[model samples]
Target: MYHSSTFFDLLLLASATVILSLLIFLNYIRASRSKPSLPPGPRGYPFIGNVFDMPSCREWETFTEWGRRYGPITYINLAGEPFVILNSLDTTLNMLDAKSSIYSDRPTFPMLGETMGWDRGLVLSHYGERFRSFRRLLHRFMGTRAAVSQHHDVITRETHRFLVRLLASPGNLSSICGGAVVLDLVYGYKVKDHNDELVHIAEVASLEFSCAATPGAFLVDSLPFLRHFPEWFPGTGWKKLGREWRADTYKVVDTPFDYVQQRRVGFTAIEEGMSEHDADILKWAAVSIYFGEWRGSDTMVSSTSTFILAMTLYPDVMKKAQAELDAVVGSHKLPTFENSDRLPYLHALLKEVLRWAPVTPFGGHHRLMQDDIQDGHLIPEGTAVIVNMWGLLHDENIYSRPMVFDPERMHLADASLFMYIAMILAVFDITKAVDDCGRIIETKAEFTSGLVSHPAPFRCSIKPRSLEAVSLIREANLMEG
Candidate 1:
């Protein structure tokens, strides 16, 4: 009886041991599965990955360093979340254009996507038939040769009017230029000064919205658990801000839309063509109707910022350009599209400004739908592929003295031929401008934590090289009218 009892005890012990071993094995497998196959990157702490390692300012420099350290394709962890960056131009092109089918989808960030509900914006929409529909419409309105030709007069007229404003008050050049363009694009009207109610509303609404929607600007994006917290909680500042932003956004959109709707009802004071209305107004109408929401403040802000920056920073380039204009266009006539082909320097200047400090510093984020080997690295599916515009723009191998702000490089012999090279661009800046901010504020500047980076509040001053040049541009504009 004693022998039999001992045998039974040994058998039970063996069974228990096997069960424990199996449990351990299963746990290991689960852990392995959770570990993503990500590229080499800086080690992160308990929750935040590499965020502490990065500098508050000079984000682009950090990105460039990471690219150098971890190859062209590098992975960054944001609060233990993995985000991949495409640092080189070739990699960016390959992901965005070559594999566009898979890479066109945007990263999922709650503030920019869910709260603001911008997964529907043409710039933020996923890669699908719906996105294609919006893109096609945008192309029809802004990209088509016929469409561009139709609005040529207005673009020139408005831009020239902006120049006049610069002449009047260079300090308000940024506000005046941006305000004028948006006014012409949206309402087919012009605000001669900075204090116009519509301009104030549009600018403030746009900037505020952008700040609130920036992905990492608020703590709620990093610690999503805070979202479940009560709105009254201090930690829920982002949530409260988001709610306020949403209302402001509605005000921005509805006010303009209602104004236009009222005019469409009976007002015949303005021209019927798009040349008279803001391009953004049309965009808002089209998007709101199609997607059941409107989020495009960022795009407007980017374009507006670009024009203002060019006016302020490109004075030297503009002076040199006027020399070209004087020789080809002469002082009596303002520069026109007809004279565009003749003035290569001005064209180069425009291109350089777009490249110098891209309004969208990070080109765009693309999603990888399938596992693939690129540049010998295993890029796993569901990764957010970010293209670093600053890196490409500042690549030493591609551009000589990349930081010198030299527009003249664009006109150097065979520069056009070199444009096809990996780090260069042609006429237009390909980066996307997204309205992720909940309600863009009218402050002329705000920082948002997102894939796209932009300039902060800046003052743009415009001064003519010669009084003769100013007279000539005005005369040319009058003749066209």
Candidate 2:
């Protein structure tokens, strides 16, 4: 009986040991499965990473190639900071729009934000209560309903002036019209020439800001602690440049806004109640509206120029759009905002222009607010995420003949472009030039490469489509009088 009992005790000990081992193995398997790996990317050097890979101009093309090589989502490290370049529209919607809560945060720029005080603007503000408030206030003033109803008269009048100016001297109509519209809307101030005092000041500030804002443009952005260093410190020339930019920035941000406040043309959020020196960040929201025009107006300018280039390059598309305008608006009068719904082709042309030559090609990079996993790949917090707006728009599968400019894709749209383009086309017929032999000279519609892309200055013939179209202009002017 003693031998039998000892045998049973050993059997029980062995069974317990087996159960413990099995449990440990199961836990290890679970942990391994739960952990995610980082997405694939090119290997970087020891310290300085993919810095040399980025070109100051047309970095979008390089990013596109990386996407093709490393898959839809490509990862790269710029120095110590990691970046995840999203290459596809599906990923853009899924990551940026769907999971925006984790991705909406803006990256901190030491030079532009702290040293230059540029972070106060809505475009660059951090995703927080302050940015939210700034956005909300802008919605109140410049919302679709308010903008159309409140500023319709001014826009219409300025547009008429632009058409007349094109009639007189058609060169650079895009720049002239854009400056006129924004100047009136922002300050109720009139602008006639590119060298107008207000326009000149705004242009200077914009150039300085663009130069300083380029990634890795100034060492201070990378080494933020350098901003705390004295202005007289060796190799601190960036500080002086920042001061000059600030002065120019204030000229546009304050000058026009002050005039509008004095004239009571529109709502003034700053003069309404908020104190500039208030501890709350929301105090700076109103001024952001003023500074926002630094890029906003230029977007319109670039977009219009692109459309002109497209007209010059693709005469068939231009004539088709013009035919639509002739039928809908007629040669009797210019196109108006009310006629936008009927001019589908013209609307498509505008959409095509924006897609063909995006104003903000790379778009502002978003900083990840928290750690996230996408497609079983780890994206840690503080990773700078580039949406690659241009890359996504130019996807060949989505946009057939993606590089080719076609307007049919944006089917359902507004009539704003219809009015703008129709009037321009009605007044001036765009065509290529002819040599002495009368052979049509092939025009190359090249574009500028920078933060904003515009057509490189190219010569094109701008003549009135018909004598009746010119007569309509005269009658329209008399009617306005």
Candidate 3:
């Protein structure tokens, strides 16, 4: 009963449907083949990829474990964000160093870097012209031949001052010495005392920024939509914190430069006839390292603090280091940079300290610029590359009993390992704390989680290595005066 035209139309419709289905089936097959390209990781939930799996604290441990289970180059997804963890040093260097051009960009944080006006920060800056400029200026001052001869006096002066400070306060004594050195280096602003208000200002700003950088710390960072909410709106504390941090960090960026200008006595980039842009580049360049944008904690302070903690935990290592110093520099004078060449054990001790507990557990987040395959896994462009320095240093295959602290591992390596080796070893005799009843207090090899993994505040009895050491510190300080 159907018309011929209608019958043909129905047949044509059926054929079209069949062809469309076939095309879709073919596409599905292709997608299935490529779906496994993403690296293997803990099977995450469908909607939230490993959100709960990402640890809020001590993530380095879990990351290393993942590396062991999966491979050196492990992958994990955090709420749709792509992350590639490089737990092996070889893989880290292969990508981040050997192929650095494509892997060196930093992960951008909207709340911390953008809203906070930290685009100027060296660590968070986009990999572009500005960053390159900052690096060049920094290299000339820090990584060049002039850096040594110029800063040697300041370092020795600070180390001696550090020894004297230990004679007074045993709690977090590294602050005065470390802060003094950085202040002198960057702004040429000599910190006459530990109570310098500028140091406190920088400390507060850096700490706030660090806490903000923690993953999953702020919902606003993940959900930019929340940023439109009112300032007084409930749960918008992150917005307020971000604003406050921005102001503080900007001041951190600007205030010191201003001080250098006012004093006109220090080595600041704010020279006559230079444009505002150039001066700003120099100012932020100093901020980049001086404040260390990642954790905002000064490198000198954190390392020095951990050195003291390490000494307290391993008295035998401290004794051996002290002996090396005594043999080289003698008790008549505190150790000098010249004595560094003769102090091999002290150099090894610094290497072990850095390895035992890295200040930057996961070195700053580096974003990939192009898609690349590593060990058969695809590292898509823009993937957040986390070089887990902690994992690399703690690899059991590389270091025997990686958890234990031992300086002897590098005794045969070389003397020129790091700068502060002989300086710290010659200064303090950090030991176990005791109560009035002469009972030893408990200490843990624990670390606090942040952009930097500083050891948690622990009780340690800090003292000078010898009475002669104390006398030397006083004599050096007076000579400088």
Best by TM-score: 3
Mark the regions of model 1 whose C-alpha exceeds 4 Å error after superposition: 1-36, 51-56, 192-194, 213-215, 265-319, 370-372, 411-467, 473-481
Q: lDDT of each model, Cα atoms only? A: 0.56, 0.71, 0.75
lDDT of 2 by residue, 1-481 (tens): 9999999999999999999999999998998888997778878776657666655767678778888898888887776777889888888788899998988888887667655767777767889887777777667656566454676666667666666767777664544446555567655677764457777776666566666656667776555557688889975788887776777666766776676666866444245565764323433444454345333456666777777778888989988888898898887777877777788888788788878878767777689999989988999899888867678889987899888888878764323344567678777788876778988877776765555666777766778877887887777766656
Model 1: how far residue 375 lies from native, Å: 3.1
How far residue 79's Cα lies from its native spot in candidate 2, in Å, is 2.0
- Model 1 lDDT at residue 458: 60
Candidate 3's error at 226, in angstroms? 3.1
The TM-score of candidate 2 is 0.85
Cα-based TM-score, every candidate: 0.73, 0.85, 0.90
Candidate 1 Cα RMSD after full superposition onto the native fold (Å):
9.5
| Candidate 3: tens digits of C-alpha lDDT, residues 154-259 | 7667666665566677675544445566678778877766577778787888787777777666765545556688888886787766887888888887888888
Q: Which candidate wins on lDDT?
A: 3
Instruction: Give a tens-digit lDDT track for model 1, residues 100-189.
Output: 777777666566555664554654666776666666655664555566466566556665555555456545425333334334444455
The per-residue C-alpha lDDT of model 1 at residue 184 equals: 49
RMSD for each of the candidates: 9.5, 5.8, 3.0
